[model samples]
Target: MASGPSDTRVLVVTTGGDAAGEESDVASSLSAHLPGQTVVRSSSTAAEYLRELGPTVDCVVAVGADADVVWTISETDPSIPLVVYGEEVLYTHVDAVIPSTASIDDLVARVQTEVSESRETNHLEEVNAKLTALSRYAKQITGCETVHDVCDRTVEATHDALDFDFCVLAFVEGDQIVPCCSTLPMDAERPIDLGEGVAGRTLETGEPQVVADMQSDPDATFKEREFRSVVSVPVGDRGVLQVVADEADAYDEQDVEFLEILAGYTNEALARLERETALRDERDRFHAFFEALPVPVAYVEAERSGEASVREINAAYERTFPQAADALGEDAADAFPTTGERRLVSDRLRDADPADQQIERSVREAGVEPFTVVLVPLERIGLSASGYLVYVPGTVPSDETRTGYSS
Candidate 1:
């Protein structure tokens, strides 16, 4: 589990014309018990002292101060814990109220407890905010279509969402890890051999590695020697993601966990893109086969209106029916001129298994001879689209078939 801030700062203020001597004694007592904490004694009014150093003070201890001063500090920065060491008062805004008669040990313990609780609460809120931003970045990563796009978005999220000082996204290419994108400038982009550096080891082992002091760690290697700390995580089997800092021991376990979560998102996005690219290549090969066929073929797909339309027509389809060159995007039923032939084609389009329905039509009505029209459902070829391939054999002109298509 991640811990809170290492050091706590407490401000002791005197109000209501009280002497500074009592405040000094209270600060000294608190300092003796608190150890490793700062105790500031201020003789000025609570409001003035708060305005000067409000941001740094984690907790406040008002000595001989009244309820009004307590309210001022609470209203000025309600997040800062406040402890009142004077006459017990019923102030709902104050965190703790200890009477002057109470032992100095009691006051010291109260201040320490309040400061620890405040720091813990602040740390939780910061972590929650970073996780929320990371979730939004995950959505953006899903929208990326290529590996480069995903890597670029990952680097952007590392800087904007994780707030890392430096970051690099590298992919494993053959026996080397190549830099895809980086937050810092790279004078010479070079590849690192697998199992050579921290990132290489991460990619080789398929695990996350965090080095608090890269200079002292034998497994760590730096392209820029200024980076002293590093946290690297594997991006599935494709690559590695690394975040670096200048100061030693800059990152903790929580930082490693956060980077791992981001790397998981990147891995999922890359896998999705790979699947889509393969599907696109398959579709392209099928289209090439459809075009090279010597028979007339028309690709028809269902539109938003639930009507089938001519999405694409092959060269032989245009040569057989020259009028179809301008028929792309037209309704499938419109391809036939006769009412009976149009009805037959439209009925096949609505059938769940159109490939089994074979119909012969006479194109003489459209100034051509009779031929057999074969409806091959696109789903037969592993396509997800609700469409069919209209195949007409022996329809192409042998001497000269104009090679033209509309898509």
Candidate 2:
């Protein structure tokens, strides 16, 4: 990637009364040392030289040029290395300041070194820019909350930051690969299955597909025949990403590496979204089940002092135990008809080891039917509650009549 003499172009700007003689000497010496380089000589001030700047100009070698002009050029395009050949040593912005009386060999050597360094600096800057762009794209994809949003953003970011004529994000749905999002609209949405096109083949093998010239390769069966360069990267187990360009050898291993990083981000985001959705669904199902139960149920917790308290109660519990309707945050001992039963329940739960600990006992009150009560321990699940209390009507059942409560 190094720039040779043919690729180098030097803009020599001459200034002051003594500039004419010095500019000729400098230009002649540069031509003799670097024969193939294009050396353009111009006499102008800082403002005039700015207008003379062109795309082909690689480096600016100022001979007796005004100090202000040199500074202006350096500031304007810092990438363009500035070499000043003059007597006054300002040390402002030039990359190399050679004395007016310096030998031609010394001047040429300094210019050559500055040009090479400038080329290296420019290459590093380009690489840093790409890395910054990739980082920004990753952040954008992570912000998306849904699978569809992530897929869409992946296409947009890849197209904007990398070299590609078209891109696609397809997910595996059932036995077919479905197009979830793409950079361009298709005449007809074509679905690919296992062992079919590049995308499908990549998905089936769980590996990346890179085709240098899709038209010439028999294995390349992608719908788009115009694309010469193609890449398909699997997005975990969910899907695959495909990018295409019209020119031969448009992409290389480095391009594939970059796209793979993007694919990894997309997969992680999709997995996170799926997990969160599952949790939300499970929580809703549990809430509905608790609300619809016919029997009285209450969640009771044990404190460090060995006291039991009611943490939550269902609608049925509120109706059957009207006196303890406002039992939330209240001591279970106070909510119950008597203190003895609450203490007995807490001690039994504290001593139990299993998560689904259950005990049955008869209830005798001043009024109403003598109900059978059951307490279930919930310690194994890491909940704060010691267990839940359930009340079943009638006398305590025999072994054949009893049905164990499932945790």
Candidate 3:
């Protein structure tokens, strides 16, 4: 969507002096540079006038006659940015401070810049509003819990946010368009492998294609009578953001940009969701060790005897030693009821080489199963010494270790 208005109805306040003529002329000239019915609210005292006009005005162009006026206006509102239009200009307070005699081109450019910034701010607010609306749909997306959820949400949000008719989000599937999400007319199949769709072609080209009329255009692939316009915006350098609309020439530069922004949001959120999914998978796999094994599967760190304590131990350890969960972050001796077991492990760790050397040994502790630890130094594997892997007999099965070598 093209962002909200700027350079529109601006209340111009010429403060610190009674220069009505100067302020009016300046406001008139600046207002003329912009399009549409421009309203110029001229005043001598800006602080009082802005209070009167309130938030109905878009921006305030203040012509500060002296240095003191800049401070006064700046302190009073600061929300209505002051554009100094006098010989003696104060640089500190206003959004932009420039002398009135400065090049007309420069003045116009700054005004355009402010307009552009306002547009960006409006665009961001719109996106925020969309996200707020999408929060209610979180449960729907969350329930899906796959990449499919992300795709569905993307289409639903885009359709609602931008008021577009048909939205299609497709992922890469070799040479095909694997439809992940869509607000198409009817019940659409998931994982669309139709290689001939516009989405797939867009992904193959790695560029967005804007077709105003599919019926007239030979490049577009669709029931031309069904949709008049289409925009195939590529996502994350790979995926596709295919938007079809009923209006002829519906996809413009603005549409492309807005869809691109939506794609960017989808990419970021999907990446985060993917990472979270991976973490959950890792956690599930980590717990699976207790299914068939002898020793308790505990991840332990070889903490410095005096500097640190036991950082973490797994559920297997908690099962083997009923108190293992509560023992975390405590000194090994404090963690285990037996002092000899703690001394043996701590001493071995304290004297052990930094290299991840396998130390296979039988140990007996109170309320715990027989344990054999594979003291693999994690720092060698680019992982901080979170801990070592403890394989207790009947709790964790044994796996081969590459005797001693770093990649």
> What's the CA RMSD for each of the models?
6.1, 6.7, 10.2
Winning model by lDDT:
1
Best by TM-score: 1
Clashing pairs in 1: none
TM-score of 3: 0.49
Q: Give one digit per residue, the lDDT tens place, for model 3 in 1-407.
A: 13345425555566424676766667677767754334454344666666666455555566645666566666666655456666545455767756777754665567557656765776677667756655644545444456766787778867777768788787776655666777775544355444465665676677778888878876566562478788888877547888787778876686787777777767776776777788778757754653344555444454333533566665555666655677677766676454334543454444334222222332335433434344433332222234454543432343453233211
Report the alpha-carbon TM-score of model 1 versus the true structure: 0.83
Instruction: Give a tens-digit lDDT track for model 2, residues 25-70.
Output: 7777777786356455565454354455544566777787776667
**TM-scores for every candidate against the unseen true structure:** 0.83, 0.66, 0.49
TM-score of 2: 0.66
lDDT of 1: 0.73
RMSD in Å for candidate 2, one decimal? 6.7
Better of 2 and 3 by lDDT: 2
Q: Please give the ranking of all candidate structures by TM-score, highest first, separated by commas.
A: 1, 2, 3
Q: Give me the runs in candidate 2 sitting further than 4 Å from their true place.
A: 1-58, 63-68, 85-89, 98-140, 159-165, 221-225, 252-254, 299-315, 323-407
For candidate 3, the C-alpha RMSD (Å) to the true structure equals 10.2
